[model samples]
Target chain A: MKTFRILGRNIRDSFRGVWRNLSLSLASISCITITLIVVSIAMILSANVNNFTSQIEKDVTIVVFLDQNIEEDDIDSLYYDIDTIQYVESITFKGKDEIAGEMMEASETYDSIMSNWTHEDNPLQDTYLVKVTDIDHIAEVAKEIGYLENVSVVKYGEGMVEELVSIFDMIKNVTIVIVIALILVTAFLIANTIKITIDSRRREIEIMRLVGASNINIKIPFIFEGLVLGVIGSIIPIIITCYGYAALYTRLHGQLFSSIIKLIVPEPFMYNVSLLLLVIGMVVGMVGSLRAVKKYLKI
Target chain B: MDQIRVQGVTHTYKSGVTALYDLDLTVEKGEFVFIIGSTGCGKSTLGKLLYRELKPTKGTILVGGINVGKIPNRKVYKIRRKMGVVFQDYKLLDKLTVYENVAFALEIFGLPKDEIHEKVVKALELVGLKNKLKMYPRELSGGEQQRVAIARAIVNGPKLLICDEPTGNLDPKTSMEVMTVLDEINKLGTTILMVTHDINIVDKMKKRTVLLNAGRVLKDYAEGEYTK
Candidate 1:
């Protein structure tokens, strides 16, 4: 019961402090809001970029075209051979006639040019559509599959896949660095703002100290004030990021990146990001105020 | 028994200036003692030492039979809780009402709401400012504000109240009013160690006086003894 009363008093004093130093409090809130917004936008962008990269990775498949003159009976052994290789997930065999028919159905130019060609005269070779367990190992799997008997070519857009993976890696690294730097900067700014508040109330704090207020009693309200500032600061950004991301996702769905690259659906993405922002805000606020109040709490 | 015992206490500031040297004094329980000295004569330093604000460089100060210098930092507040301190500037939170300012001391102890209210009103009533409960410090005169500070210091019912130049910022008339309040509080059996430069109050009141000069006691006089 006594603890509850102290906590209530701390909370009341915190709000009163906030109200008393309205301008400084607002300045701190704005700083937190702006910093969090930048962080949230970075988070949303990285989530979408991650979604797009993984999709691209999933779509990557090795195409193994067989020799045009290969024996019909040799295909079964070839399928068994490809299946045994490590990293080979699945392989689908397509005959030359099926390949030619797919080409004819895909375009009118191909249909007109291939209407007179029979399966015996088809220029297309038999092929295997091979999926690898991991996109990172796609190039190695393609190279290994090329050594198979009667295989003429193994193509999986190795250069494009490698570039895409490297680009995503760079983006991930840069995002981490940027996010960490922003968090530190935010903590520093909040700490300085709280330091100003402590400075302004030095006399009151001195009186409290002289009158026998414990160190914990003196520190609790300032910490509470910091937490309140952080929470208030995070609210605006959370609202902005959640609704802004949802809006961006809605307006640009399938229109900008198309099927090749896509934004993550907003439901779970925004929810997780919002939660992260709130946690960071609260933790930063607490830590900043805790640090700033230490120098003045010598009494 | 002595409520406070200073045994050869000496204090030296970090600037290499000696504020008090080999000073020994004692005040019995419920005694009202006046510490008189000119500026820079270590009067405030004695008041500070009594509250354990400045640990004596040479000897120990035992307050209520506990060695104040040997008390750990975490328990300093406990020792201070047994003593109230009033300052020259009133030190009232300008934004807080006279009532809130007085209640702040007990509030820090997490006293119950009704108890705080009752004690705050009682303390203010003693200071003759119960009618100015809702007024802010800025709204009150200098003397009234000092009374509120007094109310705050006494609200917790501290056994010893240390006032360091409590009237240094007020006029002579207001200073007398403030002194009268302190006198009334002292009559209620709270030991008071007041540091003052006002010779007029010192000579008029004729309480027990400890005169300090150059960080040492120049004279120790009994009740009704004037320094003139």
Candidate 2:
């Protein structure tokens, strides 16, 4: 009970300290708010970039067109050969009839041009759609499929898919690095701001010591002050993360520029980001205050 | 019983300047003793050693029967709680009001809120600042600020009070007022060890005066027996 009472008083003193040192508290709070806002933005971008990278990984596939002279048995053998290749996850055969049907349904122009083409006279060739276990090895899998007999053409967007995947990977990596650096910088900034605040109250701390305040008694309020500052500082960024991300998702219609680049759904994503911001704010605030108070308590 | 017992205490600063050399002193409970010396005579060093602020180079100090010199820095607050210290500067926190200033002493001990309030009010009343409880330190006169410092010091009901030049910055009249307050506190059974350069106050009050010169006790005078 006595410990609880002391804790309660320390908490009150921290709140009072914040209220009394309004300018210093504001400086620290604003420092956290601005840094957290930037961190949230970096986190959101990084998360979306990762999502897009995975989506691309799933969507990319190898398309191997067979020669027009190939027989049905030859096609089945070719399919088996392709299936036996390393990293080949799955293979699906699409005959010329199915290909013509899909092209015709895609547009009236293709349908008019191909409506009279009989199956025997069809210019379209049968194709095998291939998926690989690893997107990075898609090129190797495609090359192996191209060497197969009766395979006339193998296409998987050639250079474009690799470049796009690499770019997405780089984007994800850069944003991650940036997010981490920003969090570290934010913690440093909060530590300095709280240090200035504590420096201004060195006399008060000395007086507390002279009056026989235990180290814990002297430290509790300042640490609590930091906690309060951190929590308060995170409020604006959290609001922005929760409502801003949701609004951005709604405004962009859940994707950016086109469907190929997608944004994460805001429901749980924004909540998770907001929770992270809150935790960072709180932990940084407390640790920063603790460090500053420790220096002065040595007296 | 002796409230303070210093035996062969010697203090050397980090710069190798020996401030006190083999000094021995004792003060019984409820006694008032004045420690007077020249500017560099190590009077302040003795006060600091007694409070465990400055560890002695060679000796032991017992305040309230605890071996204070050997107490670790972290646990020094336990010894400090049994004594109060007043500085010449009257180190009252400018941000806290008079009431809060005194109450801060009890608050550190985690006393009950009601008891803290009662003690704070009583201490302030004794210092004649109960009516000025809400006023800030800057709003008070120098002597009043020193009284607030006194109130804060004695709020813990410390058996011994170590005052280092409590009136060094005050005018003659104000110093006497502050001295009167100290006298009243000492009369109420708190042993006071005051270090001062005010010969007039010392000669007039005529308490037991221990005179020092160059880190050595020059004279130990009884009541009404000290001279310039």
Candidate 3:
């Protein structure tokens, strides 16, 4: 009962204080909203990058080119042997004529320049396009395919795969650093604002103490005030995030990644991202208010 | 029984200025005592010492048997709960209404809403400001503001109330009326330790008076008339 009464008083007082600081409070809330929006954008960007990378990893494959002189039976058993590899997601066997046809189509522009190309004389060789369960196991899978009988060469974009891994790693590190810096900035801004407000109310606080107000009673309102500010601030960024992502997708629909890659950050991802922003907003507000109140209330 | 006891208490400020010299005094429960002295003679300091606002530099002082000088910092709130201190400035919160100021004490004590409303109305009535409950302190006259302060001081049902020249900012007539309100509250059994320079009111009251000069207790008398 006593605790409820105290909480009631804090609620009343917090509203009163917020009213008194109508302009400053609104300004602070706006700041919170804008900062939170930027934070949300960063979060969404990082999420999308993660989603895009994972999708690419799942679809990426290994291409094992074969010797032109390799026999049909050898090629047939080579596909069977490649399928035996535990890490292989699937295997696609391309014939010599199919490979030469694909090359001819690819080099169609060269036809106008060279004007002399035939499928029979095409240099492209048959290959096994192998998709692996784990991109991390790509090298081992490729090596096993290379050792197969009559396998002339093993060809996959191994360098591109490694580069993609490094890119994801670098992005992860940068995103973490940016988030830490943003959080620190938010905390500092909250602390300074609370400190100023505390200075203005110092004498009033002293009077409240004399009148028998408990320390918690005096502090709760200020903490709540900060929390409100933080919550309101985080919302602005969240709304902007949804709108911004929608705008990006509208422009990038057919221009950037393939339809499969486009499927990665669909509507559901945005929905979850909004929920993530809500959680971040709540925690930031709670933490900012707690910190500000603890530092200045001296309770 | 003596509700407050002070012995050989001395105090020095952080700036190294001596605010109080060896001082000793006592007041019984249900007593209305006037602490009289000149401007810089430690009368306010004594009141502060009694309330644990400022710790005594030496010797022991006790209020309701709580050694105020040795009270831990956090538990200072505990000591404050048992007592109320008023200032010459009528330290009612400007932001809070007259009723809220009085009810603030009850609120801090965690009294229920209905109980808070009851006590606040009762305290305001005691101070004769029942009609002005909704008015802010800034809208109140000096005498009315002081009455609000007195109302706040007593709303917690404190055993002790310290009035440090609460009437200093008021006119003579207003001061007398304010003192009358305090006297009325005292009649309900709250011990009051009042520090004042008004010899006229002090002499007329004929209460227990402790006269301090140069930070020391110059005289203590029962039913004493005030002179300087």
Local accuracy of candidate 1 as per-residue lDDT tens digits, A1-299: 99999999999998998898898889878888998898898777776767776777777889999999998888888999999989888999988888878988999999999989987788899999998887778888888888988999999887988887789778877877877887788778877776776677787777788888889988888889889988998999999988988898788873355666777878888989999999888878877787877777774
Model 2, B108-160: lDDT tens per residue? 77789999999999998888888999999999999999999999999988899
Model 2 clash pairs are: none
Go through the candidates in order and give the C-alpha RMSD of each one to the true structure.
2.7, 3.1, 4.5
The alpha-carbon lDDT assigned to residue A33 of candidate 2 equals: 98
CAPRI quality band, candidate 2: medium
TM-scores for every predicted model: 0.92, 0.90, 0.84
DockQ rank order: 1, 2, 3
**Candidate 1 pairs with clashing backbones:** none
* Candidate achieving higher TM-score, 1 or 3: 1
Tens-digit lDDT string for candidate 3 (B122-146): 8889989999999999898999999
Fnat per predicted structure, each in turn? 0.63, 0.62, 0.58
A120-179 in candidate 3: lDDT tens per residue? 565668888899987778888999988888788886787888788688778877887787
A-chain TM-score of every model: 0.84, 0.84, 0.71
TM-score, cand. 3 vs. native? 0.84
**Candidate number achieving the greatest lDDT relative to the actual structure:** 2
